[model samples]
Target: MNPEVNEDKSSLYNKVVEGKAQVYFHKTKNEVFYNPIQEFNRDLSISVMNTYSNVNNNKKLKILEALAASGIRSMRYALEIENIEEILANDFDQKAVDLIEENKKLNKVESLVKSNCDDATLLMNSMSRNWKSKFDCIDLDPYGTPAAFLDSAIRAIRSGGLLLITATDAGVLCGNGADTCFTKYGSVSLRTPACHELALRILLQSINSHAARYSKYIVPVLSLSIDFYFRIFVLVYDGQMKAKESINDIGFFHVCPECHTFYQQNYGKTVPTRGNVKFVFDSTSPYDLNKCQNCEGTLKLVGPVWTGKLHDKIFIQHLLKYLNTKTTDDFKTRERMIGMCNLAYEELDNPLYYILDDICSVMHCETPNHNVMRSAIMNCNYQVSYSHCAKNSIKTNAPSEVLWDILKRWVELKPVKEKWMGPEYRLARILKTQPKIQVDFSIRSDCTPESKKNNLLRYQEPPPFWGPGSKPKRKAEDEENSKQQNEKNQKVIEELK
Candidate 1:
């Protein structure tokens, strides 16, 4: 296959990634192209698709890559996955469509993959008009937020079909850009250690809200916050009752600004009731004041986000089993996948997580080993599990006081570090006088084990001089060199002609 020329007269580079799929993309000074960092994202998507197919007994699955730049992801799906009937790789840019077609032929997947040039939302909406034309799976991996495409995507997928959505707007979803998040997602995001988890929930909430408009609801099979983006795989279900019922999962959080204590309150859920017993929900009264019970500090109310389970344990188990059966050259990614799935599988279906570093800092003490903290919490009969959001964080059912008590005990055993002593005078004083609680410091079997090796899958270092922040400028000498190289490539193409 020949390389295509971009509008700037730059020749595209045809390269192979993940040891199998070949992609044609431009890597010039002015062109934006493929990112190697998302290899793990693509890898996980393939695995999820394979597992979903197996579990659902799906055959002849049709997929739509809504934002298929260069068609690498679509091509990868066709080449790597089984039981794929067809893949429509669509991009708004004609240049991208040309590259997608070239890559499709290069991979010899012309029969299985089709390339289209159209606005993603328009294409999906048009396809949704036909009852039989909806795809079995629609992958919306846009460059930024996927919110704009969620409505069309939901309409374009068949009932019980999978919708794989990627949101790279971490800043907005993770609370860095709170106003933007609320404006786009209709939810407030908390800037806390557990913000990544919140980010996943916020995205899900957005998807759920959009689906509800069409009397459809989503069941999140797996949700991941990896690197600079969040990916969620959900199965769409159609039913007015089910859609309305799913609204119970949408709620807001009251988070303490001082101590980071947070709690969720679901909308239309007022009084507590027994199992299988229905109670009248009072919508007239407002939710209790956003006040911290522990610190008496005014809590910051954030969200109207998804308060349901992020990952289906059964689905993750199936994914792990699927991973066990497969082998790949990207061992790092595979290992990280295993580790992350394990963590996600066991994580408490809790809303927010407590960062050990933050907890220790609050107590004016050196951070104890995570295992030690886990053991301390578990000794108190509180369930504790590792968080995928942060390394030193744990999702637990323990109350704030209990966690602080554990930290207090640790400080008594090992006095606060000198540097940490002066600023937190109140904490230091309390720690020095607080009675030591007798708790076994031994690591418990339930404590999450540290990965034996580094998992570089989540965040991979970008190639030198490649990033959105700073573009590499061509030097006076490098410009001449690039011009000569372009001329040489053009001459080669002419010779072939």
Candidate 2:
């Protein structure tokens, strides 16, 4: 039966199976919610938690699925992840929590999982008030943006705890609604070819800002721009000194609208000393931030994004090691997990990326092969890699001058049919000045990344898309009923527990 269809008011539903658990979803009404396309999301969450469990085997985990509409993910965590002491499957709707309770029994994980009905933010804030009530891992995968619950979620996790966040409001976070993003996340998001990655950074910066409220900071274990949403796993730790260091990670991107070249301006800087690196913030500007140095076009200033590393290299290496031991049936998206992790590991330690096709479009030239472009940049003695963010992305430490020079060299080899040599044409404006740096188009043997050579699935084949704020909510009365149930949910939790 289609999970989205509404059937007769009778208690009729279909059983759905994913990973190691089966749960019932209403064929008619809103007792609980389920989306089969989230299998990859659930699988990757399990894989990451399993890896986290292995790496931190000594500690027992207290996990909370903050928005457990169907409790499928919470059940899977109980059944699959190791070293777990207990799991709280929480939802605002009492009916959803009731289904969670039933599913816990059906899955025979009754001892490990408990159902709770309460507003997610209220539950988390209550947990934050007590040291023992705080969770070791908190997963928030609400329909649209998770912004409404971030502060409470950050405060509720234990130090060195893991916080998994899912954001499906791609429109708001991807620059379609800059004012909304700023209102929701306290950061303005811009439209760019690398908007996915920008979304990741914006979310991280928001979480990081929230973390600072309690003298805590985040270390991103894995930051991904997945199919329909952005899923990020970050480890939270508390220390005033360490929290102070997060300043180095906060920054903005100055993008050239014409040529698509980007320059990052970090809010803080770190200067290498003889013994220890000194942390500095509000430092003097290193790059001319007023305008695009290359094209002289107006530079659009974007973000107060997380300028720090998106993925933990060592953690991803171990994740790949963990995936190598798992079978396809064990995790259907295992290859994708491994592939994405590989690409994340190989990504240059840089902020944002330029899409090759977008750049070629600006130059009005034939698109050069990724390998050839990558080779030219690498041959220039700069590290280069594919941002797990985009297929034709160029993520390198090469200065904009070298990249523009390479494009000039490409135009030299395969010239544009017609050059619109006018001030108005972006192409003319970009190529008007001679390339100051030498560019070599010599193809190298290792141009293709290992992830590509191995035929790994580096990009997503997105599931059915959802518009902004759309996650299959019920009609108005049902939503109001859910709200009323949530308002009084906390009062009845004692009986459920």
Candidate number of the best TM-score: 2
Task: Go through the candidates in order and give the clash count of each.
Answer: 0, 1
Query: Candidate 1's residue-wise lDDT over 241-345, tens digit each?
Result: 778777677777888766676766777643446755343444342434555654455878788889988989999999989988877673337866777787777
lDDT of 2 by residue, 354-467 (tens): 899998887788898888898999888998888988888998888778888888888988878664656676677677778877778889998888888998878866655533
Residue 206 alpha-carbon offset, candidate 1, angstroms: 0.4
Clashing pairs in 1: none
Q: TM-score per candidate, in order?
A: 0.84, 0.91
Find the candidate with the highest lDDT and give its number: 2
TM-score of candidate 2 against the unseen true structure: 0.91
Report lDDT (Cα) of residue 265, candidate 1.
73
- Which regions of candidate 1 deviate over 4 angstroms? 1-11, 268-290, 330-332, 412-442, 448-497
Backbone clash pairs for candidate 2 read 7-28
lDDT of each model, Cα atoms only?
0.78, 0.85
